[model samples]
Target: MPLSSRLPILLACVVALGGCAGHPKGVMSPVAVSNKTGGSKVDMLVVTSRVPSDDPATLFTGERSPHPYLTDISVSIPSDSKRKAGTVQWPKKLPPNPDTDFAVTRVQQLKSVDQGRTWFRAHVVGGHALVFVHGFNNRYEDSVFRFAQIIHDSGAKVTPILFTWPSRASLFDYNYDKESTNYSRVAFEQTLRTLANDPNVKDITVMAHSMGTWLAMESLRQMAIRDGRVAPKIDNVILASPDIDVDVFARQWTEMGEKRPKFTIFVSQDDRALAASRFISGDVQRLGAINPADEPYRSKLEQAGITVIDLTKVKGGDSLNHGKFAESPQIVQLIGQRLVTGQTLTDSNVSLGQGVTAVIAGGV
Candidate 1:
């Protein structure tokens, strides 16, 4: 059979096998794996219904839910025997907790304190806290490690916290992943409230990627509505390549009331992934993927007190337009040096290291 024809068969098989397992009774337990070198290993635990249905897949792709969970996860690190270099491994499957009513998964141990050199849970000192929400198809370890690298590379004093939802970790399960993202909203909000209430936490900055942006916005909107304030103790809200309907974002922003973040949105016209997203959504434009050079949404966002960064001309790694957060050193530096410092980069100060035009708010 042709690969195209065989694809459905493979998907059916996966769904059948997944559905065979019964729903877990409670929250999944954390699975811990240790490396002999006393370094760190990454692992993932997933609590999901054994019976796979089209529901999860539908939720991810259809935008039925903005957040999704990776029902399964894996973590790896170098083995002790090969100190110089070897692959990480997991010995056993972590069971789900019978007490809690939700499925859970723990990905891995990040032991790198000096950035991404090695994984270590360093003591979080002072300064504000920056929370990151990863988008669809990301495993827990992937999100944590990437953000760790970004934080380390930026040399920002803020403590970084990652909110990992359950993602199916498959391209086909887009709707399922989106459903998971929606399901994780409450947990995300709880995390925000916890950090915001922390006396040591000076301010809160939330940076969400792709579909996670919906979850982030919804959580903030809910919080603001409940509190009747738009600027709820938070400082910055950065949305990177948000996979949301432009109209929906506008409505959400309006409903968020007073507790809005000092908003910053990053956009790129050449993001192929977003192009695919646009196609999947029937060509409805997304604010995060709009080109500031041409899209009027740039001016609209600026008028609404949201700063938009156009990275279409900026080149870097990750062909899928996924790694822009960590790829552009200049962008990262600007984010750390200015936004984190409670300052916005004006057009004159915004330089991309070339003769290219700087990012001007409202085109100056």
Candidate 2:
């Protein structure tokens, strides 16, 4: 059936699945992240194009903004839970509970920095920063805790930053999210350029998931086009289950020339979420769900020198199989061990488990 006819059904399905158990809300924790190096409390920096809520009752809302803003925050994970990547356990309690085990605290604006150094000097070092651009339907609080979770789980020693574009935070808002991703490209570009040019930041690793991958690609391509060169400090580009048209991805890459960062794409053929996205996109295969073993897709990725990993067989805790990159322990361990080290995911250098397969740029 056509999407027009199935729109109501799709919306209903989305609403049913939109419930996130143990999602964080309200006032953040006041505990200092300095208490533990890799302990429960984690400090995270936020860069967002979402408009701040006018009412003080709400810090930020699901509205889009013309300009970008930066914030620093501290998020605390449950002490009983493991700090492993690809794993998340929400507190037993629901919202409106101040005593909830997990909290996001200590949020302050980055008003000034001494000689380009962030307020959290311990987190920023060796000129390294890790930026995570979130996927579709994420709200302000969602992005903050997610990035904090990622930073804590990955054991990354660099500064943790999250770039949040405005999301309608609704299951039925797919079209709106797509347009919002495009609309936030300018602010995203500005954030990247600022990080790249900062003397305190020697290099930056960017990770984008779902629709954020589309925005990230467009922003980087636009930056390259306008500046006549890409930033060398933009070292690693990791896309997790990208919900983008393969053809558009190729065009974005082609426009960047040969100076772009090493590309790592995480794909899964069993991603039902991408299947829905493909349906919505008029049956155009999403870049994340393409089978690397197949023709055309494999050939195109090889030609473009993009590293594609096939994680279809890996059984994840998440039922959708869409967020394995951040929800699978094995993949998260792999990311922590290899990808974050600024190492290339070439055939000769990579190690894979029984289910995971690596398709290098030079061929299988």
Candidate 3:
């Protein structure tokens, strides 16, 4: 109950953001574009609700923008042999070697909806699009690079779109980041509506992690209330390490109407980031840290027809265990092949888990 007691919990979250010290934030260097080394490339369309920054490298700051901004970012990922799957190899310095680190190759600002449409025609394939919402404490470049790695490693053949909100990207600004989600909820809803209304988009998957999951769900809930149902074209939803309170998510799900997208959640009971989140959120359990086999949750998720994957036992990536969904090879591949592609993960597809336990709705 005391502030002193909460300090320790707050410090735990600092671990997630403390690692990137002394590095320049959001730098896009042309140097990486010259890389002839055999690596991979991922170009993504970005939509943001942060204030534009004067610094070109830091295109957007954590301050809420009056309107959304759009850009296209390209990141160069090292060769498969050089880097491990499911990890963003952050560059140590500017003008990074594309062969050794993830580097930004290009940054182009979009002035109008026509430009965004052009990008979709040029890059989107098979009428499939995957929109990614990054977690709290992420810079513009952080989301860009991380999503690039996910696309490159998972080998998902779809248009990649990133939706980023104002996150100070500091451990101390958790409340600000939480409020920012609410501020951007309408904008995010508009984004999904645009994608759903687009004639070129047939199948859509929305992948959101941590606090972004809260934003995603809220936006969808608003859409459900306004449009009578979530967009039919956006049929798959993946929530990874969601930082939302379990009880709150239940209410959100209820408001989403019967025509909601199929939901799949990646949970890890041992996630320390969520442990901190729980402390800040009045000691309520976060959706991402719930035990899929536990009481209430098990029966509730089953009745709701939601798939749950328990990643507590799965190892490797993010010592805090908050990013297993993206950091695990099997999990990322499953996301690309199953969830993102709109294929239901049935018992036959359980092999994709590799070793992580998966519980399909209706008790798999």
Flag regions of model 3 displaced more than 4 Å.
Answer: 3-5, 12-24, 352-354
RMSD of each: 10.5, 3.2, 2.0
Model 1 stretches with alpha carbons more than 4 Å out = 1-122, 354-364
Q: What is the overall TM-score of model 3 with all chains considered together?
A: 0.95
Ten residues in sequence with the least summed lDDT for candidate 3: 13-22
TM-score for all models, in order of appearance = 0.67, 0.89, 0.95
lDDT of 3 by residue, 1-364 (tens): 7857886667765565445456656666445455467897888999999998877777888899979989988888888988989988877777687888888778889998778888898897898999999998888778888899888878898999999999998887888999999999998999999888888899889999999999999999999999999999988999999999988999999999888888999998889889888876789999999998888888888899999988888884756788888898888888887778777766665875446778888632
Give a tens-digit lDDT track for model 1, residues 60-160.
22222342233332323333343221111222233422121111224332222223111112324464677778887655434544564456446667666
Pairs that collide, model 3: none
- TM-score result, candidate 2: 0.89
Q: Would you give me the overall lDDT of model 1?
A: 0.58
Among all candidates shown, the one with the greatest lDDT: 3
Q: For candidate 1, give the lDDT of residue 6.
A: 55
lDDT of 2 by residue, 59-105 (tens): 57778887777777777775433444555544454432223344655
lDDT for predicted candidate 2 compared with the true structure? 0.75
